[model samples]
Target: MYAVIRVRGRTGIKKNIADNLNMLNLTRISHATVIPETPSYDGMLQKGKDYITWGEISEDTLKELISVRGRLPGDKRVTDEYVKENTDYDSVDALATAIFNQETTMKDAGLKPIFRLNPPRKGYEGTKKPYTEGGSLGYRSENINELIEKMI
Candidate 1:
């Protein structure tokens, strides 16, 4: 799975890019969503590259994200009991594993699709430039995990 986070706001955004962001469910700055890796997703990410950052997500980070930020329909925290009661998984860890393995999605697991994250603790490197240029946008490979850690 890939973790995609919106880094910029909507001001001065082109309609096509805004539509891509909306379709990715990253409607606001600092919001994040996990999606399966696919060519279609790659295309969308490319189209909105200037306003977002993404990369393959690690299982550990995915677990931590689910345990800490995953929420139920009523805005309740996900617990082992909840997972046991509602799904085949035994706990949040199992759910995270399933998600990482592409066996299921956050929505299928009964959690909100979007993770509302705080801005990174130390702030971004630069929102206007690509990650290759030491900015916070575009792809960052494994470095995305570090950013997620700070945001979480």
Candidate 2:
């Protein structure tokens, strides 16, 4: 079963959850990660507004790079999707370990904050939108619905 423990304001993990989860022999909920896309990152990496290609760097690569550039490394589609789909398991594991662990929390000002432990099952249908790397995940932004719908 997916075990859950409600917490607030306690951002960093302590030994308690780790030890408990260890005894339970189940995965604990992941720490938060900030999403990495912005008009700036796009401007830095993207060639143009249209469907332009950057040799050896396809749309998926650019997106992964953007995701990497943006900071949603924990989610595979955002990070590992750039790697060939059929890439070896070890390679994927290495990438996951190296990249996913580097998480960030975006706290947008327009949306009200409502953090959660998991990715939304049906996009914005879940409790809160995902965080961005150093960027607010629309936390207190008035664009909560749009942020949740598009970014979560």
Q: How many residue pairs clash in each candidate?
A: 0, 24
The window of 10 residues in a row where model 1 has the poorest summed lDDT is: 102-111
- Give the deviation of candidate 2 from the true structure as CA RMSD: 18.4
Show where candidate 1 strays beyond 4 Å: none
Model 2 residue 95 distance off true place after TM-score fit, in angstroms: 1.0
lDDT of the candidates, in the order given: 0.94, 0.29
Candidate 1 on 18-127: residue-level lDDT in tens?
A: 99899999999999999998999999999999999999899999999999998998889999999999999999999999999999988888899999999999899999
lDDT of 1 at 38: 94
Tell me the TM-score of each prediction against the true structure: 0.98, 0.17
Candidate 2, backbone clash total = 24
Best by TM-score: 1
Q: 6-65 in candidate 2: lDDT tens per residue?
A: 212223545564443333222333222222345553342222211111111122322233
